[model samples]
Target: MRTGEGLLGRLAEGGRRPLVVDSSLAALYAAGSLVLGQETPAAPWQPMDALGRVLILLVSAALTVRRVAPVPVLAAVIALWLGYIGCGYWPVVNSPAVLLALYTVAAAHRTRTAAVCAAAVGVTWVVAGLLGGRYTPLPAVAVQAVAFPGVVAFLGRGAGVSAERSRRLAVLTDRLRAEQELRAERAVTEERVRIARELHDVVAHHMSVVSLQAGMASYVVEVDPVTAKGALEAIATTSREALEELRRLLALLRVGPEGEPEGAGEAAPYAPAPGLDRLEELVRRVRAAGVPTELRREGTPFRLPPGMDLCAYRVVQEALTNVLRHAGPAAAVVLVRYAARTLTVRITDDGNRSAPADSPSTGGHGLIGMHERAKIYRGTVSAGPRAGGGFEVELRLPAPHAAGGEPVGRPHP
Candidate 1:
C-alpha cells in the first residue's frame, strides 16, 4: 500500500504507533541537547549529565500516552523539564514534548479549557527562559514562549472543528440514503398491489366468461350443434383476449426500460389501457356470459387521467364479474356520470342477496381493491346491497380538468 494509505488505515483501526514517534523524538532531543550544551555560551546551558539525560528521557517517554491522557502527560513532562532546568541544563531540550501535549489537549477539549492551558504553559516557559539571565532578550523570549504554543493550539482547534463537521456530514448522508431506500420500497409495494389488482381483474373477468361458455358448449353440443359452435367460439375469443391483457401486465413487470420495442410504433400500435371507453365491450361480454347487462351515461363526458380511467374500468369490470359469479340468473347495469369536478361510476345488479358469505362482492379483495384504487385519487368506493334488494358498487373520483386534456373516447350508452 501507499505510505499515506497505510497511515490512514492504522489511524482508522485506532492502532497508531505512538511509541515509535516518541522514541525518535527522544533520541533527537538527547543528541541535540548534548551538542548544544557543549557549544552554547548561555549561562544556564550546562553539560549534559546522567541526571539531565534521564530527566529528558522520562519527559519523552511520558508523551507516548499523550493522547490517552493529555493533561496528565503535560503535567508530568512539565515537572520533569523543571528538574532538568534546575540542574542548570537548557530547557529547550524538553520544550517540543510540552508543546505537543498542549496541542493534544486543545484538540481533545473545549476551546476555553485549551486556551487556559496554553496560557499557563506560556507563563511557565517565559519564567524558564528568564532563568537564562539576559542571555536571550526578554522580548524575544516572551514572544517565542507565547507565540509558538498559541499557533499550535489554534491549528489543533481547527482540526477538531473539521473532524466534527466530517462526522456530522457522514451521519446526514447515511440518514438520507436510508430514507431514499424506504421510499423506494414503499413505491415497490404500491406498484405490486396495483399489478395484482390488474391481474385479478383481467384473469377473473375473462376466465369467468370462458368457464361459462365452455360449460354451455359441452352441455349443448349433442342437442344443438350450432349453438355449441358459437359458445366454443366465444371461449376461444375470451381466452385470446385474456392472454393479450396478461402479456401487457407482464410487460410492466419487465426489468428494463419500459419504452416500446424498436420500431414498435409502426409494427404494432400502442394499445391504450382499458377505461370507461371499453364499457360497451365489457357489458357485451357480460351479456354473452348469460347476464343481461346495460350501459348508461349521464352528463357531458370528459377525458380522464390514465390511472383514474383504469380505476373506473376495473371497478365496473370487477362488479360485473361478481354479478356473473354470484348473482345467478340476474341482470346488471353500469352508469357513468360526469360532473364538473368528479366522475362517478355505479354498477348495480338485480341478483340474489342470499349469495354465500364468501362472495367476492362482499368484503373480498374485489371490494378492497376498489377502495384502494379510489383512494389513490382522493376518491371513495361504496359497495353493499341496495335498499331495493340488489348489490351495488359505486366509485366516485375527483376528476379536475387538469387531470386530462379533452373529452374523447366516450363509451356508448
Candidate 2:
C-alpha cells in the first residue's frame, strides 16, 4: 500500500492524471465472465455482436479519463453500457465499468449531479434486466438496482470531499506559517532601526559636549592654567558619563538568555537608571560644562514606573544637551511639575541665537529618539523656537495612580 501511494504521488507530481485504475478490474470481470460461460450451464449467457464488442471496449477505455473528466466520462461509459445491453450482450461483464464511472462522477460533482446519475443508471439497470428475458422479481430489481449504484456513489462522494478538505487545510496551514515568518522578520527590522536611532542620539549629544570642552581647554592652556584645568576636568566628567550611558545601551543590545544584559565580559551592573533623582547631578554637570542650568520643582515629587522614569530622564538629558551644543551661551531652566494626572518637564534656554544646523528639530535623531521614548509611556513632547527669543522643550507623562508616590508614603495606593 505504501509503494502504491508513492507511485500515485509521483504520478501527481507532473500534473493531473486519470491513471486507469479500473481498467484492470474491467479486464478481470471480462475474464471471469468468459470462464463462467464455458463451465457453468445455469449461468445467464448473452452473446455480443460487433456493436456490443465496440461498446465494451469503449466503456473500459473510458475509465482512463474518469478522474480527469468524471462527469463526461461517466456519461460516455453509461451510454456505451446501455447500448451494449440493448444489443443483447452479457450485462454482468460491464457491471464493474458502470460502477467505476458512477463512483468517479459522484466523487467529482455535487450531490444533485450524483442523484441524477444514480437515477439514470438505476433506471437503465432495470430496463436491461427486463429486456434480458430474466425472471428478476420487481421488488428485487428495485432494491438491488437502486441500492448498489447509490451506495457506490455515496462512498465516492465522501472520499472526494475528505480529500478536498485535506488539500485546502494544507494550503491554509502553509499561508499562516508564511504570514508568521513575515511578522517575525518585520519585528526584527523595526528593533534594529530603533537601536540605530538610539546610538545616533548618544554619540551626537555627548561627543558635541566633549568637542566643545576640548577646544576651550586647548585655547586657554597657554595663558590661563586654572581655567584650562577646569575645562579638562569638565571633559573628563562628560566622557565618564557618556561611557556609562554607552554601557547601558550596549547591555540593552546584548541581553543574555537569563534576562540579563551582558557587557565588558561580565553581567551588566545593577546601577539604577537615572531619573528625577538625578536632575541635580545632571544640572551640576551641565553647569560645569559652561552651560548655566537650573532645576526647579513646583509640586510634590514622586517616583515613577521604571520605563516612564527612564523616558523622563532621557528627555531632560537630551534637551539640556541640545542647549549646550546648539543654544549659544544659553542659561537653561528645567522645571518639573507633579500635576493631578501628569508629570510635566519643561526646559527653556534663554539664548536668543538661532539653533545650530544639527538641531533636533531640523531632521536630527535626538528629537526622534525623544519622541519615541515618550510614546512608550503614552506621553508627548513638544520642542520649538520660543517666541521670547529662545528654545523650549516640554514633555508630559501620565502619572498613573499606582506609580505616582513619594518613596516613603503609601500615597493613596
Best by lDDT: 1
Candidate 1's residue-wise lDDT over 190-216, tens digit each? Answer: 988878788888998899999898898
TM-score to native of every candidate shown = 0.79, 0.81
* Ten contiguous residues with the weakest lDDT in model 1: 261-270
Model 1 residue 18 CA deviation (Å) reads 7.4
lDDT at 169 for candidate 2?
100
Once superposed on the true structure, which residue ranges of model 1 sit more than 4 Å away at CA?
1-47, 86-88, 130-136, 173-189, 224-226, 251-258, 262-269, 352-365, 402-413
lDDT of each: 0.79, 0.76
Residue pairs in candidate 2 whose N, alpha carbon or C atoms collide under 3 angstroms: none
Q: Which ten residues in a row have the lowest lDDT in candidate 2?
A: 404-413
